[model samples]
Each structure stands twice: as C-alpha cells, then as structure tokens.
Target: MNAILTVLEIVAPVFLVGGVGFAWVKAGFEYRIQFVTRLAMTLAVPCLIFTALMKTEADLATLGTLAVAGSLGYFVIGLAAWVILRLAGLDMRTYLAPFIFGNTGNLGIPLCFFAFGQVGLEAAVVMLAVSAIWSFTIGIWMVAGKGSGGKILKEPMIAATLLGALFLWQGWETPRFLTNTLDLIGQMAIPLMLITLGVAVARLTPGRITTALWLSVVKLAICTAVGWAVGTAFGLTGAIFGVLVLELATPVAVTAYLLAEKYEADSNAVAGYVMVSTLTCVIGLPLILGFLL
Candidate 1:
C-alpha cells in the first residue's frame, strides 16, 4: 500500500501539471505552453544533458553495457512497434514515432531517481543521454521517411551528445560555475514538460480517448515484456535491472506528437498515443515496481 501510494504521489503530479497546461490553452492561455516548451528544449534540456553527463562517473565497460542494452532494447521494441503498426495499417509518422520513442528522458529519469536513488539515477542518466542521441540520428531515419541532412545537422540533442562524447574522451572537468548554472536551468525541464502535457490534455476532444487506450496498452505491455526478458537474460541486477525495465516501460513521449506536428507527420495519431501511454503508465509503472521492488 505504501509503495503504491508513493508511486502515485510521484506520478499524479505529472497528470495534474499536464491538465493545468491543457486547461490554460483551452481557456486562452495558449502562449504559455509554447514558451515553456521552447525554454525546455533550447536551454533546460541541454543544460540537463550536459550536467548529467559531466557529473556521472563512467566506466568504459559498464557504459558499454548500458549503451548496448539500452539501444538493443529500444531497437527490439521499436522494430516490433513498426511491424504492428504496419500490419494494423497505421503506418503514419504520428503513430510510429510514439511507439518507437517512449518517454525515455522526462518521466523515465525521474522514475529511476525514485526507484534507485543516485545509483539508478546515474544509470538512467547515461541511458537517457544515449537514447536521446539515438532518437535523432538513427531514429529519424526510421520514422521520418528519409532523414534530412539539415535536420540531423541542426538537432540540439545530437550536438549535445557529440560534445559530451568529446568531453568524455578528453577527460574534461566541467567548470564549477557552468555546472551550477546548467543545474539550475536543467531543473526546469521536467515540471515544464509536465505542464505542457497538461495543456495538451485539456485540448483533447471527446473522440480521442479510445485510440489513446489502444496505443497505451501496446506501449506498456509490449515494451515491458521485451525489456524484462532482455534485462533478466542479461543478468541485470539491482538498480541497473530496475532502470532498464522501467525506462523501457515508460509511456510514449509527448515529444513524439510535437515532432509529428512539426514535421507534418500524423500529429493526431502521435498525440493519441502519447496521451494514452501517459495515462497507462499510472497503472503499468506501479505494477512493475510492485513486483520488482
């Protein structure tokens, strides 16, 4: 009971924050969501990635495991999603991106923090960073028809990952002042994202709920099964095990919808999947945690 409540306590705010954002837009406070999301993408998200990579200690071997496992897990599930989506005749960018790109960074990071404290947080941070790079580079090819040279060149997440990798190779110690500033900015990403989600929810029409539920089930059930199998087979233990499953089991990211919207993909399908997956996490994450924890 306590565990359940703890999970709820952490998760409920995401919905609540998202609901507020949705309501504001419906009530004519439209500009706030855009402003917050842009701030998160341009400043806070980069800061978060930089600070997390700079601060987390890395062993080449373990980092390799994390990268391999995380990437493989994503690839397996993402491939499955593509097959299912294609068979179901839902082969649009809107539908596919959410299925492929689950909420790895935002919800996944915080959940890892709760599940494993610093150790889990450390593992998740590395995986999230890696996954973010994967989404824009390899992942863009999978979803967006053909990858655009301009899109790849201009992506901030890609730039951040490359710079982080370079710094890692060079053994650079992040300056204290820069780290502090980035930490402050990075702190804003999660809440702002949640609020933006709320605003999106508020704008949901009456007919959207059914599709959301279907995608939610696919996102949670398929990914969780695949993740657990991979983690257990790989003999992942403790926080590493938990982080792998939970992050994979996370809902479809709202950014899938945003990207779909920006790229003129199937935004409606992406939005439906994101909403459904987010709601499904309320039920799915607790169940996974209950069994594992």
Candidate 2:
C-alpha cells in the first residue's frame, strides 16, 4: 500500500530519466557520451560530492565508520568474486575488477538520495568516495596489470572528498552565493549520470550473454550478502546501513567496460557485464528497497 507507493516514488525517476536516454538512442538521437560523461564526472559530480559532504548533518565519526565498512565490503566482495572466477574458470583480468566494483556513482548515489532523503545522500556520497578511490587505483591495476595509483589523486572525486572533509572538519561554510552556485551545479549530476548510463548501455555491444547473466546474479548476491554482513558488524543502521548495502549491490559499472577497451583485455565481455548487471537492477533494486524500507 503505502510502502509500494513510497518505493515507486524513489525508483521511478531513476528509470524514467535513464529510459529517456535509452529511448533517445533507439530513436537515433545524438548524445555525445564522452563529452557528457566528462562534464558530469569532472564538474557536476564533484560539486555534488562537495556540497553533500560540506552540508551533511550526519556525525563525522559515523560517516568515517561507514567509510571503513564500505571499504571492507569491497574487499570481502573482491575475494568472493575472485573465488567465483576461479571456480568458473573465467579470465581474471577481464572479470575481477567489475566483480569488485559497482556503479556506485551513477546509480547508487541517486537511488540512495531518493530512498532516504538528505541523510541517505550524505551516507551515499561517502561510499561513492571509497568506490572511486578503489576503482581508480587497484581496479585499474587489476585490468592493466600495472600501477596507476597516482591517477586517483588527480581525480576530481577525490579532490572534492578531501576538500569537503576539510570544510566539514573545520565547521566552515562557503558564502551563500557560492554555496547556491555549487548546489545548482550539483543538481545536474544525478540526472545527467542516469541519462549517460542509459546511453552507454544502448551503445554497448555485449558478448557472452549467458556468462554475463549468471555472473551478474553472482555479483548481486555476493555484494548484498557481504554488505549486509559488514554493515551489521559495524553497527551501522538506518540511512547509512541501507546505503552501504545498496551501493555495494549496484550493477557493474560502465567504466569497467571502458577500462577493458582501453587496456585491451575483453571489452565485449565487460560490456556484457555492464548491460546485464544493470538490467538486473530493474528488479533487484526494487526488492532491496522493499526489504530495507
């Protein structure tokens, strides 16, 4: 009744906006994905993270605890993903990274914000920061078999996280005018990211459909189980705990496919992962939201 309507309110916008991009591509409309992605990641998302952190009412200690638990969730899931890959006799390089990381940025952040309001978003951003740091460093290394950890420092996501933390720690506020400007920019991030997600999926040519399908299921299960375990163990509750499970259980990131293409691993397989995992979210996210609510 009321719960069903509540879930719909939270989930509908994400799908509809993403669906618009999906429909747009199907109708042969132009969407320069690279440019849009660059804008969102470089400018818009950073602003969102900065403002979210700077303005958050959550206790700093709780946020820090959530951050640690989120990292452990990733570590535990990475180990589980590795074991699954080995048992399935899959390629380590092509599959490992995607298994560990999910679309915490594009999908998780918006979903959390919708589900739990400002507090949910505050917790969600912390998880996003943790995911970005790992994906930029070890996740990249997993694909390329080389270290580019330094690149993590240069990422705007990281810069915003650090700066916002500084502001939060010092209990400082930017002038109202600048704060409003940043908030305006931040507002663009979630919708832009949702649309970009759809565009990326529409554009992908996924191979290994069967493999991707089962693997997506595995990914969802492992992340959910591990996230639950970590959150409970850390004594996280309410918005923070819910965000932990949801973010970790998000679909495989589109960036994983891009990284495979760049590193010459197996782009088509990774693309399959991205598409199938995202599709699962159509059902999986709702159920998770139902349970959490």
Candidate 3:
C-alpha cells in the first residue's frame, strides 16, 4: 500500500501537469505547440541534459552500463516489433517506429526524477540520449525510407549529450553564473514538454482506435518484458533497473504522429497510436510503477 501511494506521488504531478495542458487546449487557449516544443527540445531540453550530466555524481561506469543496456533494449524491441508487425500485416512505415521508440524524453525524464530523484534523472537522461540518437537516425529511416543521419548532426540534444559526456569524463564544470542561467533555462523543459504533449494530443485526429488499443497493450507488454529482461541480464538493480524499464515502457510519442504526417504515412492511424497508447498509460504506467516500487 505504501508502494501504491509512492507510485501515485510520483505519477500525479506528471499527469496533472499534462492535464493542465489538455484543459488549456480544450478551453480555447493559444498554446502554440510547435513553438513550445521547439523551445523545449532545442533549448530547454538540451540545457537540462547538459546540466544533469555535468552535475550528476553517478559513477561514470554505471552511466556507461545504463547507456549500453538502453541501446540493447531498443534493438531487441525493434526486432521483436518488426516481427510482430509483419505477421500482423500492418504498415511497417506507420507502426514500426512507434513500437521501437517510446517517449523517453518528454515523459520519461520527469517521471524518473519524481520516482527516484536526481539519480533516477541521471540514468533516465542517458536512456533519453540513446533513444534520441536512434530515433533521429534509424527511426526516421524506417518512417521515411531514408536514414536521417544528417539530423544526428543537427540536433542540439545530441551535441549536449556529447558535451555533457565530455564534461562528465573530465570532471569539468561551467562557471557558476552560466550554470545557474542554463539551469533556469533547463527548468522549463519538463513543464513545457508536458503541456505541449497535452496540446499535441488534443490536436490529434485518431484513426482505427480499436487497432491502436490492442497494439498499445501488446507494445506495453513487450517493452516491459524486454526492458526487465535486459536490465536483469546486466545485473541492474534498484533505481537503474526501474528506470530502464520505465523509460522503455513510456507511451508512444506524439512525435510519431507528427513524423507520420510529415512523411505522408498514415497520419491518422499514427495519431490513434499516440492517443490510445498515451491514454492507456494513465492506468498502465502506474501499475508498472507500482510493481517497480
């Protein structure tokens, strides 16, 4: 029962902040989702990643292990999802990326912070960096029929991760004033992302929602299992293990719908995945957290 309450404490703020965005959109507020997302991703999120990496006292070896475990988890999930989709006769372009890449950034980061504090955030950031690198490169290729290797070079988060990793390795710190300013900027990332997520979901037009529902269930099970198994194999315990599973099991990203739309795939269908999977997680994530706790 204490575990249940702890799960609630961790997840309540996440959902509440997201609910605020949903309500804002429903109330006919001007959200400017694209602008907020851009700010969060290009500026706020990068700063957050940089600062988190720079300041975290997590052992370098542990961070490295989490990074490796995260990469393996994604690879296994991709292979498994590919097989499932092909057998189910679904459109690979539309379904594969969503299955392979969960919302490790917008949702995963804050949830980890709430659940496990700074240590969780440190581990979660590593997972996010792994997911982002792959999503921008390999995940894009699956959707667009061409790899976006260029995007890897262009993304600020990628740069931040590399620079942060360098600092972590070298035990360097930015000037105090600069660190404080960046920290302030980074503080906007979580709330901005949560609110933007609500705005984006509110704006989506779902298609084949029933199909999406089943797919969401299956995806959740697969991801939870795979993340658990991989973390166990790596001998990960406590917060790191929980984080690996939680980050891998986040709902389908709103960005997947946007990507489908941008690439002229089945945008409405992808919207269903985004909508139902996210909504399903309202219950699903908590249960997972309950178990982890």
Candidate 4:
C-alpha cells in the first residue's frame, strides 16, 4: 500500500544513517563519541531547537497544550515505572530512569520531521524540551541520588528553548546571516545524532539479554499506551497527536547507559536495555508511523 511505502520512506534514512555508523565502527575506524556528543549537545542541538522554535508557525495555544501534555505524560510514566520497578524488585538506581525516559532527541526528532514535516518537528521539539528538562533534573536525581536542577539551567538546550520560546512569543527573527549560520549548524544535529546512536550501540557492552528483552517489551507497551491515552485525553489531533505518541514511544536512550556508567550502577545491564529497546524500535516505530500517517 501507499501508506506502507510512505512509512518506509520516512524510516529508511534514519536506520540507514545509523547503519553507516555501525559499519564505520565495525570497520576498525575510530570515533570520538564523547567529542561528538559534546558537539551535538553543546552546539548543534541547541541551534536546532532554537531555530525550529523560532521559525515554527504552529499555534501558540497548540504548542502550550503539547508542552503540558508532554510534561504530564512523563510524570505519569515515571510514577508507573517506579511502582513497577519496586514491585518487581528491580534496582531503582539502575532501572528507574531508563524506564521513564525515552530517546526523544535522536530518533524521535528526525522521525517526526520525516513523517509530518515542519509541523511535526515543531510539536516534537516541544516534547523534546520537556523531556530534556525532566531528564536532566529528576531523571539524574533518580540515578545519582542527587538533584541536577542547577545543571538544567546551565544546559544549552534549556537556554535555547527559553530563548526560542521568547522569540516565538514576540514574533522576532534573527538577522538573515545569523539565522542562516545557525540553520547550518542546526542541520548537523539529526545526522550526527543518528550516527552517534549507532556508534554508541555498537560500543555498548550489554548483559542480561533475557531480562533486557522482557523489560524492553514492558517499556514499549506501557509507554505507547500512556502516550496514546494522554494525547487523546488532551484532545491533540493530526501531527500533534502523532508526534507526541511517537516521541513517548521511542526506545531507552543511550544516555541512560552513560548515566549508569557515570553513577556506577549496573552500566552493563542498562546497556542491555538500551540495545534491546533500540533494536525493537527499529521495527516498532515504522509500524506506529504507518498508522499515524
């Protein structure tokens, strides 16, 4: 059907770019992951967020609604995940954050753009901003038993989100040259993130594959259901509803593994979750998009 081909057109480039990175690593090439991540987070992603927000012509009310919906959806998911983890006797420090947060940045953003074009990106960006804020703050605290509220304020993405919102509210535009430069920088974000995702997965040392597989299945089911429920309850329609569900249903983030390693909490187990969940999404997302589109 035409719909199936459309979904393929949208998903093929995402996985293909990731495959390139996977092949690069397997071919004995060196990739400085930390450096690439720093570049994306500190510079490229922020620019991307800022420009997207500034240029987006989506209704302000719609953006506001999506923002609140996103925040509520994450909070509800976190609570549910916490309950499940506790009842299942899982380590909170190791599993809680991974269960709550998904890969809204790397995979979700580009998928939105491809599936629904500019409006989808706009809605997805709002969700991403909400996720970024919570992930840096509450998500970090869950992993490290320490609050990162101050650190969230220092994040470039946070600043860009605020500034971009301000620009959107005020109907302001950057100078043409500056906008073009930022746009160029922002354009690097998607490809770099997709490639980095593949590279990171390639390098991960996964353990407990059986456990990871089951947990990932649980995560997918819970997240997809919650996202659909929340978006429907909020009365989100068209691209907004689709973007919200897609972003929320993304796999466990690679950052979750990095955070576990940094906090000395079963990094290999977290890596297993990351790998299993991401591989699951390779099939899952396109199916979701097929229905959404």
Model 3 per-residue lDDT at 102: 96
lDDT by residue (94-117, candidate 2, tens digit) is: 999999999998899999999999
Candidate 3 clashes: the total is: 0
Tens digits of per-residue lDDT, candidate 3, 1-293, equal 78888889999999999988999999999988878888898999999999999999988889899999999999999999999999999999999999989999888999999999989988888999999989989999999999988878888988999999999999999999999999999999999988888888888899999889999999999999999999999999999999999999999999899899999999999999999999988899999998898
Query: Which sequence of candidate numbers ranks them by lDDT, best first?
Result: 2, 3, 4, 1
TM-score winner between 2 and 4, please give it.
Answer: 2
Positional deviation of 117 in candidate 1, in angstroms?
2.8
How many residue pairs clash per model?
Answer: 5, 0, 0, 0
Clashes of 1: 5
Model 1, TM vs. native? 0.84
| CA RMSD, predictions in order | 2.9, 0.7, 0.9, 0.9
Give the C-alpha lDDT of model 4.
0.92
lDDT of 2 at 265: 92
Winner of 1 and 2 under TM-score: 2
Q: Which 10-residue window in model 3 sums to the lowest lDDT?
A: 31-40
Query: Against the true structure, what is each candidate's TM-score?
Result: 0.84, 0.99, 0.98, 0.98
Evaluated against the true structure, the overall lDDT of model 2 is 0.93
